[model samples]
Target chain A: MRYAAIEQWSRQQSVLHRRDARAKIGALLAFLIAVSTTAPASRIAFAGYALLLAAAIAAARLPFPALVRRAALVLPVAAGFALVLWFSDERARAVALLEKSFLSAVATLLLVATTPMPELLRALEILHLPRLLVLVIHFLYRYLFVISGQARRMRLAASSRGRLQFRSAAGALAVLFARSWERASGIYRAMLARGFSGQFPALAPPRWRAADAAFFIAAVLASVAVRVAL
Target chain B: MPVIRVRGLRYRYPDGAQALDGVDFDLEPGECVAVLGANGSGKTTFVLHLNGLLEGEGSIEICGLGLKKQNLAQIRSKIGLVFQDSDEQLFMPTLLEDVAFGPMNLGMPREQAVARAQKALELVGMGALLHKAPYHLSSGEKRRAAIAGVLAMEPEILVLDEPTTSLDPPGQRELADLLRALPQAKLLVTHDVFFARALASRAVFFDRGRIAAEGTVEEIVARFNWTQR
Candidate 1:
């Protein structure tokens, strides 16, 4: 459901949403690279990165609290590594690890929240990412809702039939897995019926506009400036 | 002329279940035929072979083109197979994208594909929901969107497997009306007796991987006792 909400938000009209997906992807890469390579001791640069993401969130007109809450999902994994670093007496790196990871998640979320999955996948393809990897990502994103819906239905069915014991829950999960496999094959058959071969044909190749170029350039320069100064 | 023709079709699953046994079928141009069968009777399996999705020992032809690996793309474009489960058919993130998928895959330009998809969605009375996620739609809406996706491909023959499986009365009626309005030849596989009577000019009964009977819709229904008690 979170993904669905983000998908809905991506379709909403906004200045940030109007930019080309390729440009946004480029900007996201630059921001991530800048954030990752910054010196661990440079608290000022980390602050600047956080401020930059905050500005983008505002500009995109997204719900700041919700986005921040969602971005914090990355913290648990980052904190695990940070804990190890702290025990090794690298406290500065530990703190920087959490900050950089959280900022990176927010920045990545911004790109995804503004650009639809189709456009995002197309952008990845245009960037010469591996075709198999792009296709995997595409199918994974498309089917997540389906799998989740099945899980919800199973849960409801279980609840209506009385309390779902652990044994029943485990059985339901196995059924879900099998059902998903069957559905995947059916989806493939539908795709074949529509003439899908090995390659997924694009309706139109992405066209880079002057505005897209300007956005990419500005984003890269701003991120670099923040990393270098402050 | 026959829009679809098949003879001596035989298929066995990898697990050794014989799903189709010497099945012969034909679809005349501009005709609608309903296939009635019990569970595991091979109705779905037969339809899957129409667009070369499943291969078997059969001599099949669609729109005068032989069903072969080299002619698969052309055959697929001539026959649009809407699966029984709307959820499976409607896989794209948005309704419009799902509809446009077929046309896009056929190498249509983006503008043309979008236009075709819009037209198809409008035909199914789902034009307003073009941007909605497929998962957000109700069952009836999902079925309409799935049909729109196939219709966007502009196939000469439409093969629908259990088109009314989850539809309510009104939804079934609406789908019947929609199918009647379309001029494409249709092969409908369903167990709904009233629905078949409404849309199918002829009917065939499948029993154990073969066509057990074929005749007028009324005659087949009576002969097979297909209606509910």
Candidate 2:
């Protein structure tokens, strides 16, 4: 259900959503590079990056509160690293770690929010990412929730016990692992039956347009300008 | 000529268990045959060989092409194996992409594959849910989408393993109708006698890796006392 919400968001139409995934990817990369290079001491630079992300989120018509809340998932992990730096007498670096990680997450989230996964993965493949890696990510993203749902049902069945579980789930993590392995084997056989010969095929990849190019150019300029001026 | 031909088929599992032994079978053009057997009687193992998914000591000729390392691609294109679990078969992010997977692998151009996928989806009555993710489909819809995935390959023969496993009566009836209209020679591996009666013109019964009996669905069911009743 949580996965479905993000998928639904990506399918909604907006200017940012309409832009090609490649363009959105390009903007994301530029923003990441800019934020990563900007110093921890540059407070203005961090604000500028945050401003860019907020504007992009707005353009995409995504719910700001939800997006911001989801992006916070990165903070706890970032804060762990930040906490070490703070205790080690590196206060600026601590703040920098949090700022960069959160800003970077929002930027990446913005890209995925606007572009459906298949299109985004196609863009990555078009950019010369390894085909095998793309296929792995494709399957992983598609099946993670399915497997988790199996886990949930397994737990509920245990509760009902009245309940037990699917194929005797019975509170055993090993059962989940075994089930996952079997599920993977079944999927592999299905793939072989459908003529899969190492490469996963997709329908026509999206075409790049002038609008995409313009968007890419503008994003890079804004990101670079912030890094240099701020 | 038979669309599918098998001779002297034998297989032994890695654990030293013999699954299939000295089996011979044939399927005529556009003929649907049901295969019935008790659990672990080699029913699933046998169909896995039709598409060259398993290597065994036998000869398998699908749509006139011999099953071999080099002919696997062609052989697979000739016989679509729809596994029982629709969840495993419909793996793509969306239904349309999943259906298109087969054609694209056969080196059909993307545009042509898209067209074929759309036509196949329409055939299965899933045209409107092109963008729907596989996880969202009801069990019956998932089953149809899985069948559509196979149909897009334009196979000459259809081999469905336990096709009615999770369907309710109405779902089973819908699937039976959809499968009935298909022109491909079909191999139905099922325990559902009523389902077999509805779709298969003839039947084969497997027992401990051998074709123990072959006849009409009623004869096999009666011979084995296979009904739940």
Cα lDDT, all candidates = 0.90, 0.91
Candidate 2 wrong stretches, greater than 4 Å = A1-3, A162-171
Q: How much does candidate 2 score in TM-score?
A: 0.93
Q: Model 2: per-residue lDDT, tens digit, A8-103?
A: 899899999999998888888988999999988999999998898888888889999999898999999999999999999999999999999999
TM-score of each: 0.92, 0.93
Clashing residue pairs in candidate 2 are: A160-A163
- CA shift at A116, candidate 2, in angstroms? 0.7
TM-score of chain B, per candidate? 0.98, 0.99
- Give the clashing pairs for model 1: none
Mind giving the per-residue lDDT tens digits that candidate 2 earns over B181-213?
Answer: 999999999999999999999999999999999
Candidate 2: deviation at residue B61, Å?
A: 2.5
Q: Kindly list the per-residue Cα lDDT of model 1 for residues A58-89, writing each as its tens digit.
A: 88999999989999999999999999999999
How close to the true structure is residue B93 of candidate 2, measured as C-alpha lDDT? 79
Query: Which candidate has the top score in DockQ?
Result: 2
TM-score of 1: 0.92
Cand 2, B chain, TM: 0.99
